[model samples]
Target: MAQVLEFKLPDLGEGLTEAEIVRWLVAVGDVVAVDQPVVEVETAKAMVEVPCPYGGVVTARYGEEGTELPVGAPLLTVAVGGTGGPGPAPAVEQGAGAAAEPTGTAASAESAVSSEYSGNVLVGYGTAGPAARRRRVRQTAPAATPAPVAAPAPAPAPTRQGPVPVISPLVRKLARDGGLDLRRVRGSGPEGLILRADVELALATARDHREPAPAPVAPAPSVAPAGERVPLRGVRGAVADKLSRSRTEIPDATCWVDADATELMAARAAMNAAGGPKISLLALLARICVHALARFPELNSTVDTAAREIVRLPDVHLGFAAQTPRGLVVPVVKDAGRRTAESLTEEFGRLTEAARQSALTPADLTGGTFTLNNYGVFGVDGSTPIINHPEAAMLGVGRIIPKPWVHRGELAARQVVQLSLTFDHRVCDGGTAGGFLRYVADCVEQPAVLLRTV
Candidate 1:
């Protein structure tokens, strides 16, 4: 006898309750080895390849790809034991299969499968306690209709959309942001799992094949059309939720100061000039931030509203905002206060690359004590950006450009930048916040000032 066992989705940790099926790695009648990845799914945080712990032949899949299922929903059913045919399709004996089929109102077929699973717990979730026997729910006899009805019961309406198979979350996000239907894109990966390259190629091909709107044949009174709708989901949704929380919960204030960055930029150029492994500009700024935080530790702390206490953090887990094709993400550099400029530069490089590839793990995104946002890359002078919630403060750096300023007791064109500090008013008053921003500005004006604490 062959036992048909059902496998449910496991808790993927990090408090995620559900995941969207990204791709199916196995199909019906396929032979699966224990611990082999059966499906790839996308949660709110990252894309994960989920491995099946049961070794068997797949009998049926519960949900289609792109289906959002709860943590405990049935993922697939497998038929194990009993070998008959050479391949997986004929694994079950013909006699067992015939006896199990539900023919009429009389015969019922079933068997219990053992609960023991391979000790492979991917995504940090595993079955607990002793294995238990599982039995199929019995179906009641169909009630007789008033007339001579012979057809089977009608199916209910579908609430969700059909499935689309794709492996990369980045690909899905791209299609979502561009308002493109993922089902229309062709997959190029194994078993037709869509890759990032496939999406990009499809987009390029679409653009190349598209023609102008015929200029309306004749410009008919150009009228304003309705705006396009964009649903906030995935990375963009996460950002929106956090920003809304920060705005609603925290009483935050912003303070800005213009700093002379000539000395700092010159010092950076000099370091690179004589260097083996040159330090990055962001690294130099980060080093200054650590020294500034050391002097004013209040800004490095977070407010424990529940405990009604201000929790001052000891180690600075620095987070830098990196913009990727998916969206803006902040990858943390752990124990940044203890790292040198060279080390910080190396870590920043590694994390930025991971962010670009959308390969950042959950650990890389959390545990950020402070955020350093260099919005200057967008060529902006300054912005009063919202603070990253739970974290008490964020330092925003603007573009450093040549501007006329009073230097050396005379008017001169100096490379200057605007630095803004947004802090939770509950954590610190204007005095502490202003002092921290002033120290940072002083470091920019005189790079030598940092040597005292460096």
Candidate 2:
């Protein structure tokens, strides 16, 4: 007899409370081994492959693709001590398959899987305690009845007055922001689970059916045309939230300078010509930023709001912006101040490739003490960058192009670039910020200035 064991979604680290099912790797009726990846999920931080800890036959799955499930929700169930051999699970069609019939009691399932479980789910998270046995609740559909056309009631009906069956905190926030009561809106998901779609539909229906005000005495105003609507979720939503918080919390100021980068470009060309590994322009810029921070340490610090003190970081964990198919992401290079330009180039290349492939982890994307934004790739001249929250400063690099400039007291065409520095006013005064930017501008104009620091 096989003991049917349930596997709930494990907690992914970095305070992620939920994840959306991106794809299902193992379907129902397939046998799997311990610590094998069974599904791919996308959280706000990154894409993760979740592995099943218990080895057995995958008897059932819970969520469909694109469904957002909260932490601790049932992911799937496996039958341990089954008849199937443990070589490997044969690949099944990648779709949500119907669950297999229950084979054993919950108590039996819990006892059988405890010994075989590996207790590892993600890189930083593990199961500290034994898995709790959950009794599956099956909701039976009520008899069909004719309902209003505008608001068709969902099956199992709405809970008139009880605890709302909501999963995602995002859905709860959505309802709260819209001033809608969850007790009135019906749910369409399993066990009458309240989904974000349900809340959106209920809000739309209410707008369409609201009572019209009394006709104006003179004339009526023309309605504005409806534009396309895009939901703020996933990576986009995370970026929006971070930017909003930065704007609301940080008192930031921007100062910029136009510098002649002709000598810096010439120095890079020389270095790459005689190098074993090709050096990138971004790496040189990062090196300059690192040295500049050493001179003005205040820009490398973060403010402790509760403590009302400046926390200056000893290391320079540098973050550089990279645009990918998913959106804009900043991957950090750990302990960047200790690394040489060659090492920085290699690390930047590795992280950029990972960002492009959507393979970056939360650990790789966080712990950045300072950010370097190169909007020059977009063919822009300058931009006032917003400081990444909690971090004290950011350096924005614009396009380096040929412009007429004084070359040793003579008008000539030179490779020129714009550098902008955005810093938190609360962390340092204008004089400190100005000194840091001036040092960077000097290094950019005269690459030999960095050699002294090196």
Q: Per-residue lDDT of 90-137 in model 1, one digit per residue for the tens?
A: 332222121122222211111111122122223322111112102212
Each candidate's clash count: 0, 0
Clashes of 1: 0
Candidate number with greatest TM-score: 2
True-structure lDDT of candidate 2:
0.77
**Candidate 1: C-alpha lDDT:** 0.71
Worst 10 residues of 1 by lDDT: 106-115
- What TM-score would every model get versus the actual structure? 0.66, 0.75
Model 2 CA lDDT for position 302: 94
Q: Per-residue lDDT for 40-78 in model 2, tens only? A: 778888776677767787655776787777765568877
Predicted model with the maximum lDDT = 2
